[model samples]
Target: MSESGKTNPMDEQTPDAVTEADILIGRIVDGEADEQDRTDFERLADADPLLWRAVATRHQDMASLCDEVDHEIAMATTLELPDFVAPRRAPRWAVALSGWAAVLILAVIWTTMPQSKGIEGLPPARPVQINPDDELTFEQHMQQYLLAPYVMGELDPIVFRVEELPDGRQAIHYVRRIEAFEFLDADEELPVNDKGHLTIDPSELHAPVGPASIAETVH
Candidate 1:
């Protein structure tokens, strides 16, 4: 097996010829050995106490290294930056003077600018008179009149009646009007059931429900 006459022990040992003790020791080191395997390894280690001490020291070193790595990671994640400095604010008089200065500059620019009349060789522009009534259609005027009461909160429009005109056009009319009750208590709240109906007694229709009653029922 060698150039010399003597044989080498490493040359005689093959990958397939690995001993069971080596396999047991490898499994224990890799944390893959079961209870029976660990027991067998313990017995083998008893034969060589130095080997057991070496393995134990290696395990302790690995655990310490893991803890150090974890500590480094935690420090990196929770790293903090220095506090930011606040900017100095200007005095009240300075701020007011700056505003006034800006206004004066704008005024001076506006006054210095020349007003445009008409382009050269073009006719002079005439002022166009617009009528307020001509701006809105007849339907828009009717809508404003119909919703005036509702907008004022005096009455709410309920029924809408649609009628066909003689010229085949349609006209809508708001028939019913009712006043909505305004609750005095701003903190008054009513709960609704699964069906979306208010969970209130018929006798307590006008009365406001307090938060204590609702909390009691909820608890």
Candidate 2:
């Protein structure tokens, strides 16, 4: 198989040398051979009995390894495992008591600490003593009305009258109004004048006494 009259040493390779038949046999054993590779392997296997025996031996070895692995997995799963105990949780009442204890401790710490008198260069705050006989100023009355829990939205204060008292103090009379909306059925109609304005009766309405009154006297 050489250009010279003598035979080439490379052409007569040893049995250990890898050939195309060996590669095709390896592909077939590994299950990676396509239709063309399978056809080629079949042709090679028919030509050589040794190659066919090698592939059959490889398949038997693979099946035996798979069976051994499956047996190991089954034995591992069947072995007795240690019992797992979950951590116990505290009672609801105990948790609540601990929270209250923390709050009490914080309260004690806060109360025991020295209270600040006043900021530096600023005068100490004086305690205000309110007299029941004295009428509230306009600003004080407005502040009280605004801070009331029932008050909502903007306050529409209409000054009805302003007069000077005998004590040289001015008295202001005002009506505090609040606008609100209510959902009604389609058939329900509000009483409106010819001017297309809703009319409400003042006498039919009622409110809380003292600072919460709609109409109040402020000095």
Candidate 3:
């Protein structure tokens, strides 16, 4: 305070200033701040080094998390499922159950079944391998297992029974299981055609895709 014969603004930091700075930091992190907001944030940072440091730390953490997610998605795109002998699939059930329902049922049955005394009674389970030259990483393999149905379009509304609601909305009920993750008893509302099939307007997919959108032609 004595150096310039004036009180420092940083020394008079109020609770409102701290709250505003936090809001600014969140906006910056989310990439929602405007140029003027950025300018004000910088001004505040220059006035208070501690505030700048706090923002920097949070930014770095968020960046690291984003990198990790990107890495997982990259892995998922390249991963392959383990080769296994196909078992007979049961006929499709009329009602949609959670993704893990069938798997959990099988697991329970397998656990309760009597074990064979002879080694030749059942085939030995194949060993899983993940060689970098020919196989995907363990993480990638897991991601593949979890996302296989979604990737293959098996989780589409067409695959599940759709019920009409009293309000003219269609309820799509199904479990989309991905490895250990289970979308349990999940349901979604969808528009339906006169034939009672799920229908989606292409225009609703994207603003630019609509016939009336001028920005689409300009682009």
Taken over the whole model, the C-alpha lDDT of each candidate is: 0.40, 0.43, 0.43
The better-scoring model by TM-score among 1 and 3 is 3
How many clashes (backbone N, Cα, C below 3 Å) per candidate? 0, 0, 1
Per residue, candidate 1 scores C-alpha lDDT tens digits across 1-219 of 211122334436763454455566567767999999989867766766555665665567778988899887875654433212111332221121111011100111222224311111212222334343343332232233223211111233323455566766554443222122212355656555889655643223343245345423432
| Alpha-carbon RMSD of each model | 29.6, 33.1, 20.6
- The estimated TM-scores of all candidates read 0.24, 0.26, 0.29
Candidate 2 lDDT: 0.43
Q: Using alpha carbons, what is the TM-score of model 1? A: 0.24
Model 3 off-target regions past 4 Å? 1-18, 70-208, 211-219
Question: Distance from true position, residue 162, model 1, in Å?
Answer: 52
- What digit string (tens of lDDT, one per residue) describes model 3 on residues 38-116? 9987887787767676767778989999999988887565444433322233223222222222121111122222431
lDDT of 2 by residue, 152-192 (tens): 32333455666676766555543434332222345756556
The number of clashing residue pairs in model 1 is: 0
